[model samples]
Target: MKKIVSFTIMAVLIMGAAVMNGDYVSAASVDGLNDKINELEKKKDKIDEKQGKLSDKQKNTEEKMAKNKDKQAKVNNEINSIDQKLTKTRNKIQAKESEITETNQEIESLTGQIKSMKKKIENLKKEIKVLKERIEQREKLLKDRLRAIQSNGGSMRYIEVILGSQSFGDFISRSTAVNTIMDQDEDIMQTHMAEKREVQNKKSEVVNKKKQIEQKKKEVEQKKASLQNQKQDLESLTSKLNNQMSEKEQLMGELKEEHQKMEKYKMSVAEKQQALSDQAAVIAEAKEKASSEKERLKQLAEKREREAKQQKENSSSTSGSGSAAPSSSGGASTASSGGSGIFIWPASGSVSSGYGGRDLGYHYGIDLAPGYGAPVHAAASGVVTRSAVSSSYGNVIYIYHPQYDKSTVYAHLSSRSVSLGQSVSTGQTIGAVGNTGNSYGAHLHFEVHEGPWNYHSGINPFPYLP
Candidate 1:
């Protein structure tokens, strides 16, 4: 009986020690699982914080984009107004030219009329000279007749001749002959005077006509000069208007380019936000998985504790309780550490402008000039979200990093080497720098965003660039 009691005591001690060992193993497994759950929760918290920052950035960017669009619309209206004014100015110039041509033609016609009048005046002067000569001849003839009459003893000689007549018939003949000669001389003098007066009147009329023609010609010439001066003024004004139109067109082009850029940026931002939402879903799923695993671990720990307690109770009784070994059958999965938000330089160059307000309003990217056709590289490993020509950015590319919940943009490219949905690694060549879109010189415009690519989502790129 003593030997049997000793064996029983040894068996009881062994069984108790085995039960305690099982309890210790169960506690250790539960502690390890708890640590894994805490780590997963920490990761999820970090993701939440990042998501919150991105959401705020999205809101601000959207507001800024709306304001920019409004300003762009106003600029477009102004450009259209300038175009209308330019068209009207051009029409006025054309009308002025036509008026000048017509005025020149009238002046030419008046010049011909003045030449004809001058020729007519010369012919009239010739006719007046002939009339003057005829008048002088008639006057000399009258003088000669008077001289002859005097030589013949004038009126007394005529009376004596009539008194000395031998017969009455002879006396009558002498009286009749003297009267006829005097009458003839008087008639000749009157005819000469009349012809002279008529010629003088005709000459005077022609002279008046010439004077009128000359006055008309002078007026026409003056008109022509005025027209010429007007034409010159109009041409000058037209030239000025053309210059103004050219300047306005340039301004409008710049404004349009800027507007397009803003629009593209807004679109990119919106897309990035969608990507973020998708990433958030993934993170939520991961958190849910972690929660499920934690619950499983807790249940397993409780079950092991219950079994250990039951084993202890059975071991204290008179009967021996067979205890099964604790089995640990759980696994933990960890997420990969994503991008650090640091980037390689997309192009080899010096920074020309930084993110912030500028002459053109809020600028969301950095400008780098390295001459034309400089190779542009990816800042980080990502999937190409966009790769195509943009009216404002030229050949541009957008890269999205799901792991980091961030996006990058490269603008003003001469050529694009990547395509949408293409995967790219860090420092991979994606395009070439250029002076396209709203850019004034050959350069690269790059941007980074913590969330989606939005107008206000951009941070200073220098901090993230090498």
Candidate 2:
């Protein structure tokens, strides 16, 4: 894969150097540094916005929780009130049942009394009718007797019945007898009529009483039915209130969890803020130094390349030209010829360390781990880039290949076999191997480049190498 390391290396190398110290200007001047600082401030503003959004979410969650709590409290009250009403209604229903029982007994008693009154009224009416018939029969008999007397030359008149009687004593006797009979008949009839009236009156009064009791019973029943309905309503309300309480409990639990999350986020933001502060300071400083040192580094590279070319020309004078192995891999033909744009293999070894991900400090090169001091070949000949010793990556060599107008870097070299600007072949020996800066053992740290040692602009070597 191509080493994806492209950078304005000539400038950024100088920035890295300045950052090691506080007061150095790099390839990009102080104006550039201020601009970078402004950029960092913009990042801080974004972080603030993010923190505000989280805080707002926390507040909104809390407000919702509070409302749910209030609703729960009201629900609880309703539940309690409903329970009370249910108890009262149940008691009322029981009381109504007892009243209904008593009212039923009273109605039964009134019915029996009416039955007895009906029997008595029937007997009295029969007696009154008999008495009326007796009076009519007696009147007819008296009229017949009076007619017989009148035909037998006897007359009965109001005066005869009084003064024209055979004697005043006889008239008094006749009047007494008539008056007595009339009195007895009237007495019988009056007693019988009076009894009937009394019975009828009693029956009417009893029926009215029964009706009154029934109406009272209906009212009581209606009230009881109302109470029962109220009781059912209360029960339903109580159940709803209970559910509300349960929901409130759940909301409270959620609220607690939310509060905890808010705290955790706040702590995380604080830590992130501190990290950002440190990073800004470091990047600003590094950005400055990286600019200047990178240029000097490139200049040093050009110097080495000129020297390597001279070495190659001198070697051709002494030994004609070194014959390389035939190109075995397809498309690897005539890779190095007269420096007319062909890249030589800098070393003979297996290629390694392809590149891509940007998170780790980027690697702009390939690593070729070979047996110690195995001949390092020039890959598709070009002038040498540089050979140096340093930190992180030590004993490094840079080669500017002619084919693609690209530079290649080799590090951790045990020894160098060429000078700067030295032209080499596709498989010319360039260096040996040894353990160098930040190296575990003898190996070749190789790289390809476009212009110089800008680590940012390089692609992985795996895709490009033959």
Q: Give each model a TM-score.
A: 0.52, 0.29
Consecutive 10-residue window with the lowest summed lDDT within model 2 = 1-10
- Model 2 lDDT per residue over 116-187, tens place: 766766765676567557656766766776687688666445345556558768888878876776687577
Alpha-carbon RMSD to native, per candidate: 13.3, 20.8
lDDT of every predicted structure (CA atoms) = 0.69, 0.56
lDDT of 1 by residue, 1-466 (tens): 0111111122223433443554433454445545544654564566566657756766776776677667667766776776787687678768877876887787778777777777877787788788888888888987897898899988788778778888889888988887887688778978988998889798789878878878877887787788778778767776876777677677767766775665676665555555444434433544454456446546766876787778788787856756656464322222232434368788887888888998858888899888899899998777665676666776788776544546799998999998765668899999899988777889999988774344357777777664
Task: Name the candidate that leads on lDDT.
Answer: 1
Q: Which regions in candidate 1 have their CA more than 4 angstroms from the true location?
A: 1-113, 155-180, 216-258, 297-466
Q: For model 1, what is the C-alpha lDDT against the true structure?
A: 0.69
